[model samples]
Target: MSRATATATGFIAVLLWALLALFTVGSSPTPPLLLNTLCFGIGGIVGLIWAWATGSVPQMRTVPLRVYAFGALGLFAYHLLYFSALRLAPAAEAGLIAYLWPLLIVVFSGLLPSETLKAGHVIGAILGFSGAALIISGGGAGLSTEYLPGYLLALLAAFTWAGYSVLSRLVGSAPTASVAVFCIATSLLSFPLHLMFEETVFPTTALGWASIAGLGLGPVGFAFYVWDIGCKHGDIQLLGTSSYAAPLLSTLVLILAGIAAPSMTLLWATLLITGGAGVAARASFSSN
Candidate 1:
């Protein structure tokens, strides 16, 4: 694909991810563990089928075991923490906090060989963290002691995803195959946890089923493959900077879904986060 097409694809993937909070809203009849199990299980099956159709199945075995191990653990941890946090705190707050992965990516990317940390990146990181702080202080139903654990989980989700993204760049496997492996591994790991700690509760309504399907097909599934392509072939700086839009879009989605409402704090947080991303993007391009 052309750079423009690849970049657009990347943005579309992120936008689809924004809908995750919307789909998962309200008290789930399904436990988080089982929800993840079903979602990733379905997604993994789809991914495997896709990989087979695209003749990427053979490539799966060619990948290093270390890559598979990291991908599985990272993906598993990210979703586990993210879904758990959503149950504990308001989705908007948890999402914004979890969205810190982009900023973390910017920082961690600097650690790669031949990459340099620039002043704009530093400034952008500061601004981004400031926005995150603002959100934590005022974003959701208000930060309280009750939500502390959720907040920490969201932060850990961010960290896990950042590390995953960075490590993905080092892996030489076909992205689709790798993602399929990750999904299957996560599902397998979730099985024991689900059996041990949570009862299976299937979706009771059509809307709930639809939400599960959407999560499996889009955000947790095909989007990962598209993102891998984007990162490999798209305008890296643009993708990096525009990633901040994911949280903003996700917040808007929640508002429209009646899961959240617009507020001054969210507006201010948007400005800070978007501005920070822009600064970092500019610096990244200039450095290149």
Candidate 2:
């Protein structure tokens, strides 16, 4: 794909991710690990079906096992750390820390071959981070020493995701169909974790089951595939900076769903995140 096309594909993931919070909220009472299992399982199955239909199943055999291992471990580790962080720390604080992946992606992309760390990319990333920080923190008093472990875990989660995304480019030759295996492996790993840690609670409502399906089909499923394409061929720095829009769009989704009310904080966040993305886009155009 052309860089522009790949970048657009990657941004679709961000759009899908905007619905993540809403779907997760709707799928209430399902423990995180269990939810992870179900969603990944569904995503994996659908991906496999697509691979088969497109005759990409054979291409999967050409992919190195180590690549599959990396993809699976990356996905599992990220969720594991993120869930643990939220369980141990305040959600707001933990979330803010975990959300650092986007900025990290922008920074880390600088190290990639042929990529330059432009001033606009850095400035835009900072602006995006500032906006995300506002939405996540809600102007609350910041982290406490008491939750140090949780904060650390959250930070690790951020690094895990950022590293995964950037390193994905190194394995750009891997077939996108391999992501199905990653999803399946992640689901299998979550099974043991869920069995050990969480009580089984199936979705009791239609909305809950529908929400889980929505997640599997959109955010957790196709999002990853497109993201792989973007990271491999797109403007990684611009993609990273624009990812900040996820939170802003997510809040807007919540408001539309009547789950959240509009506020000044939301307004400011919208401006900062949107403007940051605009700046990043302009920089990307200049570089191109």
Candidate 3:
């Protein structure tokens, strides 16, 4: 896909994730655990199909199973923390705070052999982190107590994502299958956890299925794979930086769906974030 198209796809994936989170709010019959598990289970299947569709899975022959094994481990650990964070935090808060991973990627990427920190990178990181902080803490102004736990969870999610973002780069050229295989494996890991904590499986509901499909196909299955591919060929900071756009699109979807309302403060905060993301994307890709 072209850069614009891929970016749009990524943004849409994040928006879908946000929507899934919103749908979970007033669910009647399904518990969050089973619903989440079903979503991931379905996502694993979708990722497999998507990798096949894009010819990413077949590329595995060129990459060693050992490296792919590492990729799988990274993917599993990342999802474990991501899901746990969601259970602990609010969607908007977790989503916004977790947006920091791109900046984290830059910081970590600097330690890599060829990566360099440009002035744009530093400036962009500040703007991005500040904007994300504002959104999570409350309207880009100050922090609030009620949302504290959510902010922490989101931060942890960012850490998990950043770690994977960095480590995936080390795997170098591993086909998309590595991530897909790991996603499927990690998804299975969570199912047992779900069963252990929950009483019963979720009944089949259209809304329930819809949320599962969205989470799996859009975010977990597709986006994660796309991200891994980018990590394979592109600068992690660039791909991660462009991710700031996801929350902007996601928050807009939330507003349009009446799941959440927008405010002047949030608008400004988004400006900072999206602005930083643009700068960072441009800088990271310049070397390409």
Model number with the top TM-score? 1
TM-score of model 1 vs. true structure? 0.91
Clashing pairs in 2: none
- Give the candidates in order of TM-score, highest first: 1, 2, 3
Tens digits of per-residue lDDT, candidate 2, 160-250, equal: 9989988977875688899999999999999998999889998899999999899889888989888878977998876766687775677
Question: What lDDT score goes with residue 122 in model 1?
Answer: 92
In Å, residue 263's CA in model 3 sits off its true spot by 1.2
Name the lDDT of candidate 2: 0.77
TM-score of every candidate: 0.91, 0.78, 0.75
Q: Give the runs in model 1 whose Cα sits over 4 Å from its true position.
A: 1-3, 139-143, 171-173
Q: For residues 1-288, could you state the per-residue lDDT of candidate 1 as single tens digits?
A: 798998888777787888877776642667788878888888898889988898998778777888888888888889988988888877887788888788778778888999999999899888877877877775555656677788778888988998888877787455556788889888899989999998778878888888888888888887887777787789766777667788889889998888887888877776777677667767777876
For residues 104-149, write the lDDT of model 3, one tens digit per residue: 7766666688888777777877887787777666774567667677
Candidate 3 residue pairs that clash: 43-216
- Residue 165, candidate 2: C-alpha displacement in angstroms: 0.6
Which pairs of residues clash in candidate 1, taking residues 3 or more apart in a chain or in different chains? none
**lDDT of each prediction vs. the true structure?**
0.80, 0.77, 0.63
